[model samples]
Target: MLPLFHNLLLQLDSASGILRITLNRPSKLNALNAATIEEIRQAMQYALDAQAVRGILLTGSGDKAFVAGADIAELAELNEIVGRRMAEKGQEVFCLIEESSKPVIAAVNGFALGGGCELAMACHLRVASENARFGQPEANLGLIPGYGGTQRLAQLIGKGKALELLMTTDQVKADEALRLGLVNHVVPAAELLPFCEQLLGKILSKAPLAIGMIIDCVNAAYDQERHGYQTEANLFGRCCGSADFREGTQAFLEKRPAAFTGE
Candidate 1:
């Protein structure tokens, strides 16, 4: 494990089965630089393999900008090949996050635009502060979202709304985001952490394997023509057949809240 550092803005912590990854550049509003991206990817992979971690939380430092955007300086000099590589790498990392076994939640405190919004959207679900604003502003920068933004945005909101957001480069407020189903919950900045913890707690209280299956099913639900639904049904049935499911059912019948072992 790496020791925490001041300049090294990415903060990683675990408590009560929740491992948090905070983009630590408050001075710069937690912008995703290449270094930051590498660190984030590393932290996520660590949490993915760490048995002690069952749920993950991702947020930004300070009260503004979960991630303002990607570090533009790093991309300013990139050629076509380099740009393509960066996009591919970002997509891979973002996909890994979306498909992580441990459910990851994004706590958006402020302006989550461009890559910032993309990062939040990559999480299993988003919980935003009342002041948080979200957008995919790459179009305005003469660049498209390099992460999974283009695909995932449409999956989260509808295609029409996603296109509107992308084309207009307009930031959507928390209420609008909630209405669009972009965020699960919206609370004041003072309560952002607690709100995220509450949602994470709800997820942690369930069977771990079941949570994983549920995430898989929901992500699949976006593709109506694909075998996603069938796959989800099959996985759901398999979970129902697990020992954890049996114990959970028995516990329910015995008038007790089930303690799922996630077997």
Candidate 2:
């Protein structure tokens, strides 16, 4: 059963081990306010704790926007201290999503600007609708992306392309985003969720423990302090000692499907 969270900023539903979380502030273009940010953090924690939730699909409520940006009204009220706190809060929440044990896929339906774009980047994978748009428009506001966008954006695309987008505040169409390696796939708006589900379903069929390990290892690649190869080797050694590994190898030799218990 899916836990019933107060639906102030999000609509949460679950089925077949897949949790679908829709950012629910269409009237506000799904902008991230303080309350909404807290709700998202709580929702991600819920997904992480729930054994039934093997994967997550994140999207927005309306066709107009996946998320337009952070709430400008809220931003207008921020003093230097408050502004720094707000950025830290957002970064913490997004980091939780990025470091999740289960795979989280962002299905961008429309505009994903500023914090919206950062949110999508935090996900394990991203799928965009044909009409979706992506950008970091904080430069126009005399601000910079504070939710790890400066880092993740450069990592996904190259440093030069990321710098151009960051400096110019250029909005890229879904096709261009795909070309830049921002999105994994671009489909019609109507098919975005279904496409993500189909892809997640395939991943969910694999050994869950290995899936988690893969997430950990891949994330380590982007950590400047950690050597990616060393991380991978450590994880590989750990996997070799797991029951799932034994079962997988045995099943391979037996020419049969392996039943992974996630052990």
Candidate 3:
């Protein structure tokens, strides 16, 4: 069974092995608050542990936003210590999403600003709608992005443009975001979830073990303590030892489709 949340909706398509997590606070534009963040952590944990879930798709309930930002009222109540704790909590949860073994994609339907943008960046891939807008506008509120945005934004785009956006508090339209590599694809708002499913379907068809290893190796590239090349080699060896790898090679030789059981 799927985990229930007060601020989120979880639906899993067993045939596709895709778990869809919809941010349901449409009245507040699905703003991220402490409660919502905790719920996301719990939901993500469930998705990761569920054997039937091959991929995850994240989006907001309405067309207006994936998530606008953090709740302003919540922010207003933070002191320096509490603010630091909040930032740490958000970073920890977002890191869980980033390091997930299963693929997690963001279907950005509309505004993805501040914490929202950070959340999107944590996903393995992002597919944005034509009306989607991305920004790290925390500067406008006398703050900076606290949830890995400063790092991921620069890594996705570049340091120069990321700095420009972060410092200027400028919004990037979907087309521009696509051009800058912030999103993998941009489609009509109505096609957002469909496009994401199509993309995930393609990815999920591959060997699950290899897919997870690729995720691990790619993430290792950004980790200062890890050697990317060594990590890749180790993961490659692991894949070669997996049952799926043997099935894949044998299937190719036999001119038949390989059935990977994720073993």
TM-scores for every predicted model: 0.92, 0.96, 0.99
> Worst ten-residue run, lDDT, model 2?
5-14
Candidate 1 pairs with clashing backbones: none
Which pairs of residues collide in candidate 3?
none
Model 3, range 174-216, lDDT digits (tens) per residue? 9999999999999998888999999999999999999999999
Residue 159 lDDT in candidate 1: 94
What clash count goes with each model? 0, 0, 0
Across 1-263, the per-residue lDDT of candidate 2 in tens digits comes to: 44454433333444558888888888888888998888888899988987778888899988989999999988989889998999999999999999998999999999999999999999999999999999999999999999999999999999999999999999999999999999999999999989999999899889998999999999999988899999999999999999999999999999999999899
Question: What's the residue-level lDDT of 249 in candidate 1?
Answer: 88
Which candidate number has the best TM-score?
3
C-alpha lDDT of residue 172 in model 2:
99
Q: Please identify model 1 stretches exceeding 4 Å from their true place.
A: 1-15, 222-226
**Highest lDDT, which number?**
3
lDDT scores of the candidates, listed in order: 0.84, 0.91, 0.96
